[model samples]
Target: MTALSNRALNRALLGRQFLLARTDHTPLEAIGRLVALQAQEPNWPYVGLWSRIHGFTHSQLTTLLQDRKVVRSGLLRSTQHLAAADDFRRLRPLLQPVLDRTARSAYFARNSAGLDTASLVATGLELLAGAMTPRKELARRLAERHPGRDGRILAGEVELRAPLVHSPATGTWGSWGTRSAVSVTPAETWLGRPMAPVTAKDLIRRYLAAFGPAGTMDVQAWSGLTRPGSHR
Candidate 1:
């Protein structure tokens, strides 16, 4: 086996990620090829695209979001990410175990003690159905249902447990400092599609195509997903 030096590996990643040089790919094309963009900061996706796509503009991404061609949701590493609608449908289900595990964090466990989580998620979903509700408002409504519990914590749990996506306005350019007012909706409702069934092997291959020649641990680190030994 030929050994690849650190520089060689770095360049390989850059080439795969389009960091070596910007490309003329459309925003949707770039986003799809990358699989997902780290977007917890709200503005990072725009920035990420700006660095990789030639002539990329904030409106380009905003339009894609408004058109439901792309979606901003909690994905890889259980953090916010911007994924093309098609990719999101496939990726979310494959990465659901990670999201489920995140919902079991200490904060949710302690805050929701003795509460029926299934019922809670159902109520939250019901409240958000057919409408994009701001996080604070969602929290308030959930709090009203379970008075005395932390509304913020309850809302956070709903997001972690449900396949929800943040409204486009929240991720649009110039919306960074106003994330608190962002709205959440069910991913399926927003995208008008069902979550696609995908295997760990499929995810692994996709991840490598975008950020690959990587080891199993690298994939796990990037995706917050565990792989069977055979997949590795």
Candidate 2:
């Protein structure tokens, strides 16, 4: 087989990601095509969309959030990402193992040590079940339940262990202005649907469609999960 040159690879990626040319796709459609947008910062997705989407406006993306058509959640690479609702439903479960692993990092381990993780997750869920709650509030409630434990750490662990998404309003463009709190709710509750089951193979195929011509290491880099088989 002929080897692809660097320019070829770069153009292919740009084309696949819609960076080669401005696209007419709506904000939701663009997000769906890309699978997910890197969104550690709440405003990054809007800037990302603006660069790829023709005539894109901040409100367009915000509207999708308001309508629950798109969600901001811990996903690929176990970081916050903006994913369309259906993609989030399908993708989050496939990435759960990675997210769980991230929750076990030294930072969380040292802070939440000696606490029952299952009980903590349950308590966190209960607190978030009624409504989207601020992270600090969840942490406070958990601290109240387990006095002297770091509520912030417990809350952080719950966030990592549980499939949760930031409240849409928190992710809306300009929503963070003058606001110190960020709200979150269970992904299932926000989506009104359970996480769809998917296998590693299925995830790889989807990853390829959005970021393919990629090697196994590339997929691993994007997903933060190792695949069992060899890659071409």
Candidate 3:
């Protein structure tokens, strides 16, 4: 094995993360190696990937999402991310606790009070099983079921309660096109695969590979995963 100094390790980390210079990898490959691409805003990942991968095109990523090779799902600090289906499946489950706790927060308490979280998740999945549903539509349905409530809150809760993926068009450049609304798909339907299993050890290893020689707190800060001791 090659010995590396701390600065060398940091530089390598930055290089792999696309901080050093852009490369020629396809979006799929870049995302696979990076584990997940930050996607809080629909177009952020596009810009992010563009900065790192040469000749990156919007169509390439949209096609990947449409074809089920890549998926936009909740992860990495309980935010939206673009990741390979394989990575999303494994990572989503690991963030379950974080999702659950977020659901318990004042947001859900104030907006989705008296809501049966499990049933809400089930209904959201049922609504999204056949096709991608706009966040507006999903929220409308939830509000309709509950009556006298804000759908946006319900929509946000659905995200916390279920593993949801933003649809291709939503992530497509200019898809918003003067619209303030958002749309999303369920992760399972989007990827055509069941959720992947994850363990703390496995998550830690992947985190280290992607953002390594770091403290456990850094991992916790990135992935909402908590572990004792700083070293892997």
Which predicted model would earn the best TM-score? 1
For candidate 2, write residues 106-130 as lDDT tens digits: 9888877887888889989998875
Q: Count the backbone clashes (under 3 Å) in each candidate.
A: 0, 0, 0
Question: Lowest summed-lDDT stretch of 10 residues in model 2?
Answer: 223-232
Better of 2 and 3 by lDDT: 2
Give the TM-scores of the predictions, in the order they appear: 0.94, 0.93, 0.86
Candidate 2 Cα misplacement greater than 4 A, ranges = 175-179, 228-232
* Candidate 1 off by > 4 Å: 228-232
lDDT of 1 by residue, 1-232 (tens): 9999999999999999999999999989999889898888878888899999888887899999999998888999899999999888888887877888988989788889999989999999998875888999999999999988999999999998888998888878788778878799998888778888577888888889999789989988999887633432
Q: Name the regions of candidate 3 deviating beyond 4 angstroms.
A: 1-6, 176-179, 228-232
- Given candidate 1, what's the lDDT at residue 189? 84
**How well does candidate 1 score on lDDT at residue 207?**
81
Candidate 3, 91-206: lDDT as tens digits? 78877777777778897789777778788778877877657777888888877877888877878888877888776666665665623456777777666788876777877777
Error of 2 at 72 (Å): 0.6
Q: Name the lDDT of candidate 1.
A: 0.87
